[model samples]
Target chain A: DTAVSQTPKYLVTQMGNDKSIKCEQNLGHDTMYWYKQDSKKFLKIMFSYNNKELIINETVPNRFSPKSPDKAHLNLHINSLELGDSAVYFCASSQDWGQQGTQYFGPGTRLLVL
Target chain B: QQQVKQSPQSLIVQKGGISIINCAYENTAFDYFPWYQQFPGKGPALLIAIRPDVSEKKEGRFTISFNKSAKQFSLHIMDSQPGDSATYFCAASGRTGANNLFFGTGTRLTVIP
Candidate 1:
């Protein structure tokens, strides 16, 4: 079974378009995170939710918003996407919010904004 | 600012050779360090990790050497095989309960048989 799964493996949209990526984890983890990997292969954390509570919010623009309905699901929504929004978005989950725990990541959702 | 710095953006090695990737961090608060391996079209997966208290850790052919005083760490693969060709990433995390992790750019390792 896929421990962590994401919807829309690929997303291609025009500028100013809005879209959402959904993530789900079956590992029964309490902490879920959203990361953005740029073309340079630099991974940066965007947001993190622990048990449906917002915990870490990076310097990402307000256009991106993350919603977690429960501990098992976390979704990212981007408003008025721009060219800079094009990148791979990854969802990860860990048993706890502690650094000692290892995070399990999903395949990833590639987004392209023309 | 790039908190973690990694060297040798790409590397090529022959079969049965050793592959080493180095990384250094500026944050002394970082207590946990981990190395992740990623294949094309896939997310990064944790291959090995080390804490500040440990100097070295080994799992199978993969090993992690950490230097607490220098605030640096390295990943060494023994007898590298073609199957091990992939992009490797080094990451560090500070504060015990925070889930935020600062990641290095990446290192693409190619093992030619």
Candidate 2:
């Protein structure tokens, strides 16, 4: 079974078009995270949720918002998407919130804005 | 600022040779360090990890050498094979409960037979 899964493996959209990416994990993990990987292969953490509560919010712009309906799902919605929004978004989950457990990542959702 | 810095943005190694990737961090608070391997069209997966307490850890042909005093760590792939070709990332996290990772610019390794 796929431990972590994401929707829309590839997304190609025009500028100012809004879109959303959904992520789900079946590992029964309590913590989930969102990371952005740029064209240069630089990975950075954008947001994190533990048990459906926001835990970490980095310097990302307000155009990007993350919503976690429950412990198993975390979705990202981008408004007024700009050219700079082009990148791969990955969702990861760990066993618990406090412990340093290994994170399992999903096959990323690649987004491209023209 | 980049919390973790990795060297040799790209590397080419002949099969059966050793492949080395180095990384450095300035945050003394970081106690957990992990190396992740990523293939094309896939997300990064944890290859191996080390803590400040251990100087070295090995799993099969992949070994992690950590230097706490120097705040440096390295991944050494012994007898590298063509199947090992992938982008490797070095990351660090502090005592945060959620494990907010600070990743380094990845190293793309191409192993040729």
Candidates' TM-scores? 0.97, 0.98
Clashes in model 2: which pairs?
none
Which one wins on DockQ?
2
Q: For residues A75-114, could you state the per-residue lDDT of candidate 1 as single tens digits? A: 9999999999999999999888764568999999999999
List fnat, each candidate. 0.81, 0.81
In candidate 2, residue B93 scores what lDDT?
A: 92
Interface RMSD (C-alpha) of each candidate? 1.6, 1.1
lDDT of 2 by residue, A1-114 (tens): 999999999999999999999999999998899999999999999987885457656589999988888889999999999999999999999887757759899999999999
CA shift of B92, model 2, Å: 0.4
Winning candidate number (TM-score): 2
Off by over 4 Å in 2: none
Task: Please give, for residues B1-113, the per-residue lDDT of candidate 2 as tens digits.
Answer: 89999998999999999999999999998999999999999999999999999999999999999999999999999999999999999999988657888899999999999
Candidate 1 error regions (>4 Å): none
Error of 1 at B71 (Å): 0.8
Q: Is the docking of candidate 1 incorrect, acceptable, medium or high quality?
A: medium
* Chain A TM-score of candidate 2 vs. true chain A: 0.95
lDDT of 1 at B37: 97
- In angstroms, the error of model 1 at B79 is 0.2
